[model samples]
Target: MDDSTIRLALERHWAASDAGDFTAEHDIYAEGAVLDYPQSGERIRGRANIRQSRLVQPNTKRFKVRRIIGTGDLWVTEYVLTYDGAPSYTVSIMEFRDGLVVYETQYFADPFVPAPSRADLVERPGTEAP
Candidate 1:
């Protein structure tokens, strides 16, 4: 698939997610597609597994794509995900075949918050700590 087609597919996928329309998002993936999340050391095989593992989440919200880059059949996107109670930035790499996404891998941001420190959590005198 061309760059524009892949971009359009991602756009539709985000739109579907914002509206909680799982079917629309699911349609973008090819049968038996694979998705790997290296940071989590987890690999989800097939559309069904991906849907259950990646797509389904509590209080799911749309992940907005900040930027997209494509070369040949590969598409990469930087996105901000607002799900559950925390928001995070991540990158996704997609491999497309015949206008459908055949493989996808995501990498979440590292150094997540500069790592919380024990001293930073110390309560001051006569003050309640957060």
Candidate 2:
């Protein structure tokens, strides 16, 4: 698919998630699509199962898209997912075929404080220099 089309699809997916519309968010997948959570080591096969799994989630979730970079049938979306008021950095890599997502893997990481040892070597962005 073209870049614009892929971007639109991703926008729709994020919008749906932000609105708590699970069905619309899950509709981007094909019938036999696979969704993997690498952090949890869980593989959810089939779009129906994936939808069902999300339906059982207990936390109040919100998504803020940070960046989307992709070409052809492969795309990566970086976003912050806030669950119960705690933000988690997330990356989702999706492989699409025939205009539908066929395979996807997602990674989640919680925010952490910078290591003191790296303070001298690293410059933090969006912060005033000390």
| Candidate whose lDDT is highest | 2
For all candidates in order, the CA lDDT equals: 0.79, 0.93
Q: Write the per-residue lDDT of candidate 2 for residues 1-130, one digit (tens) a residue.
A: 7889988999999999988999999989999999999778999999999999988999999999999999999999999999999999999999999889999999999999999988899876678566
Q: How high is each candidate's TM-score?
A: 0.76, 0.92
lDDT of each residue in 9-115, candidate 1, tens digit only: 88888778667777887788899899988987988888877777655566767677788888778888888777764677889898888888899998887324343
Quality of model 1 by C-alpha lDDT: 0.79
Instruction: State the TM-score for model 2.
Output: 0.92
Total backbone clashes of model 1?
Answer: 0
The CA-based lDDT of model 2 is what? 0.93
